[model samples]
Target: MAITCGLVVANIYYNQPLLAEIGRTFRLSESEVSLVATITQVGYTLGLLFVVPLGDKRERKSLILVLILAAALCMAGAASAPSFVILAAASLCIGIFSAVPQLLMPMAASLASDEERGRVVGKVMSGLLIGILLSRTISGYVGAHFGWRTMFWAGAAVMVLLTGILAQMLPRNQPNFQGSYGGLLKSLVTLTRDLPVLRRSALVGTCMFAGFSAFWTTLVFFLESDTYRYGSDVAGLFGLIGATGAFAASFAGKSADRKGPDFGINLGILLFVGAYVLLAFGGYYLVGLVVSVVILDVGQQMTHISNQARIFSLLPEARSRLNTVYMTAAFLGASLGSLSGAWAWTHFHWPGVCGVGLAFGGMAYLLNRFYGRTASVIAPAL
Candidate 1:
């Protein structure tokens, strides 16, 4: 399931390293090409709001397979797109269907015992994070050697293969919610209203992801600029360095299991701030960039894993809905970050991008530090 999660989630990120090539192909600017990444996250937010809730109302394995197949079709569209508009449209569709990992996470949570849930989620999340980081490496090399469109075709083929393998390997999970889809979505609001931690966690998640997205969305442009005079292939190698965060995801899960999740969350947010500080001051040097990306990615996975560990423990029956609320907010932040990162790069360059990351990280720190200070919200039994 973890491997499958990584493969499907990777489709959304494959375009990041290829943004420069795509812009060259379409004769567009950095800000204009950024719409591809932004719209993709917008589609993902929509899927998190609408599609992920269905996980509770539908058979889990079948839902994952269907979404994977849909993602494969969308990737094919992306590959064949002749114009920028068509490519953006296909990217939107790809984001919408690429909500497969959200479904898979809840399935893994449901199957595991409470005692081991954090470890289990960490293991699966390691794969997802690896997929996200490695997708850049793979796509960067593929886009440089072949054309950018070849990466999309490769993504499609991988999804098709994942669908076939998961069908035979995954266990069939019965639906927990018997109500209509409309009712299921409505309960998301109810869940938000009732769970204070979910709301706070969602907010923190939003800021953290916004910072994370801002860095990644603008990185290739920075690399391609006169300062580095590098190509996409070299830019992609950073993902390999960032893969150290995958280990952080696992370690964070264990930390949350031993210490409280609050400890992990705060530590993660601090790492986020420190990473931006390094990037702001040291980003001109390749070693500084390398070190900052490692810090950034590790912080991202730590916060993400810790947040999921806390949220999944909230309500056994509403894991999907809880994830829906949280992930929807997170992806929405990502969309905003991508848009802002592009605009900042156009207006103020690398320092501006670093400023954006700092602002978001600081906001997240404030929220995490102050929330539940007076009183603690209790998590329900699994």
Candidate 2:
């Protein structure tokens, strides 16, 4: 499941480091090119709303297989695009179908015992996180060497192979939801309304992800700017630097299991604030940027892992719907972050990007500290 999640979710991030290359290919302005990344996130959010809830109503393995296959086809389309518009359209479709990991995650949660749930989700998430980080690294090198289209071609082939392997290894999970698709989606709203923890968790996760997204979305542009005059490969190398800290994901889950999700979450948020402080002041230096990437990634993993552990404990039967609500809000933040990062880069450069990241971190800290306390009364400590 971990490998599957990693490979599947990597599709959403392959465009970040290659954004500059894609823009060059199309002769687009920075902000205009950024719509590619933003539109992809918007597509993912749509899928979370329309597709992921079916995890509770359909056979999870089959749903996952179909999504993966569809994503593979979309990747092929992206690779063969004749125009910028076609590439962007393919990216949207790829994002929509690439939501397979969300389905697999809830399935992992459902299969695990209460005592093992956090650790299990964490393990799967580790793969997902590593995939996200490494995809950029690989795509960067590939995009630089073979062209950006090669990365998408490679992604399509990998997904097609994964589908065959998973079909044999994945366990068959019976549908737990007994209702119309409309009813399943309606329950998502009801779940959000009734659960304070769900609302608080979603908000905190959204802010954290927004900050994370802001940095990544503009990183290539920052590296390519006059201060550095670097290329896409260097931008991709940061993904490897960030992946070095992704192992913290499993530690975060263990911490959540042992000390409660709130402890891990607080620690993560503090690290996030500190990372931005470094980026805001020291980002002009390559060494400072490298160190800050490690801190930022570790903080992101900790907060994300703890947040998932907290919400997954809310209702076992509704785990898919809970995830749908949380991830939809989070990806919406991602879309907003990408759009804003491009605008900030256009207007204010690196300082503007750092300012946006810090603002997001501050919002996450305040929301988690004040609102999380109230939600804790009703939420399980796990």
Candidate 2 clashing pairs, residues 3+ apart or interchain: none
TM-score, prediction 1: 0.98
RMSD per model, one decimal:
1.7, 2.2
Candidate 1 — which pairs collide?
none
For residue 328, what is the lDDT in candidate 1?
Answer: 96
Stretches off by above 4 angstroms in model 1 are 372-382
Question: For candidate 2, which ten residues in a row score worst on lDDT?
Answer: 373-382
lDDT of each: 0.92, 0.90
In model 2, how many backbone clashes occur? 0
lDDT of 2 at 132: 94
After best superposition, candidate 2 residue 358: deviation in angstroms?
Answer: 0.6
Error of 1 at 5 (Å): 1.0
lDDT of 2 by residue, 37-91 (tens): 8988888998998999999999988999999999999999999999999999999
Give the C-alpha lDDT of model 2.
0.90
